[model samples]
Target: MRLRYLLLTLGIVVLGLLSRKTSICSIDFVRMYVGDVLWAMMVYFGCRLLFVSLKKSASFGVALSFSYLIEVSQLYHAPWIDSIRATTLGGLVLGFGFLWSDIACYTVGVTLGFWVDSLPGWGRK
Candidate 1:
């Protein structure tokens, strides 16, 4: 169970890195942040691996909410967090300070993730 989650997170993180390296920011990220898409996919995969009940799809919403939480947190950047954000990985996770527009982006990404999980091969037992 734990390993599955670890791999899910790793895959999402790798996707984030690839997105950055590829400069594929065409996805209206200003209105829907980047990580939420990958995060939603991770949530789907995590629930699948754990054999979670279908009702637990709420967890994907919760994961989507988390990105907003992180963005709001940027409004008050602690020194350590700022330093961590300076790191390439941290920068991707934390982003550049706070931007209210990202809330919408996250919502879109989360919804997209939900649809992805609903695809033919996904979220199956």
Candidate 2:
């Protein structure tokens, strides 16, 4: 179960990165928005990977709360935080600006994550 989540997270992160580099006319919207969605799911799965004992609801709650907190943090622009957001790595981890759309993306991502997690796993050993 843990391995499955880890692999899914890795795959999503790769696709998200690729989405930024590749310009597909049909998926332009996905390229723009999917990253946010994948990021939210990555956070959820990463949390689950660490706290393997966490119940599904608790994991979802933590993921949603953490993602929301990151989104909310964008509203602040202190010099220190701003400096961090300026760097590439920092910018990726902590986004530069706030968008209401991002909240919706997070919701969608977390909901999908929950559904995936609930699936019966043939991969489980």
Candidate 3:
């Protein structure tokens, strides 16, 4: 179960870096955060699916919170990491910088996570 979460987190972090780098989309802060949030939600769902024993809502909550933590980590300056984020495809996956709106995104993502998981015959044990 823990491994599932870790893998999902790793995948998301990679994707965030990619998005941050190759984003042809306008860096409209809101849009960026929303995309970030949605991706986080997907990661949450993926994580839950990877490990089936965890409850639906609980997995969503955990994923959302962990996603928030990663967003927060962007505030720190990691030169090598920033370079990597700027260069590699993983950079597009990993996020950069801070945005308060990301919290809203996290909330929406979690909600979406719940909704998706609740789909009949989808994520159930």
lDDT minimum window of 10 residues, candidate 2: 116-125
Off by over 4 Å in 1: 1-12, 22-56
Error of 2 at 1 (Å): 2.5
lDDT of 1 by residue, 1-125 (tens): 44744576678767755655435555555225465556545645555555455443675656666767877888876788889989977876677667655676666656666675666754432
Clashing pairs in 1: 31-105, 32-105, 32-106, 33-105
Question: Cα lDDT of all candidates, in order?
Answer: 0.62, 0.84, 0.67
Candidate with top TM-score is 2
Candidate 2: residue 25 Cα off by (Å):
6.3
The TM-score obtained by model 1 is 0.63
Model 2: lDDT of residue 30: 77
Candidate 3 residue-wise lDDT, 38-105, digit = tens: 57766686767565787876777688777788777778777887886786564445666777877778
Q: In terms of lDDT, which candidate is stronger, 1 or 3?
A: 3
Clashing pairs in 2: none
| Preferred candidate (lDDT higher): 2 or 3 | 2
Lowest lDDT sum, 10 consecutive residues, model 1, at 27-36
Candidate 3 or 2, higher TM-score: 2
lDDT of 2 by residue, 1-125 (tens): 78877898898888767767664435778777988998988888887888888888898999999999999999999999999999988998899899999999999898888888877763221
Clashes of 2: 0
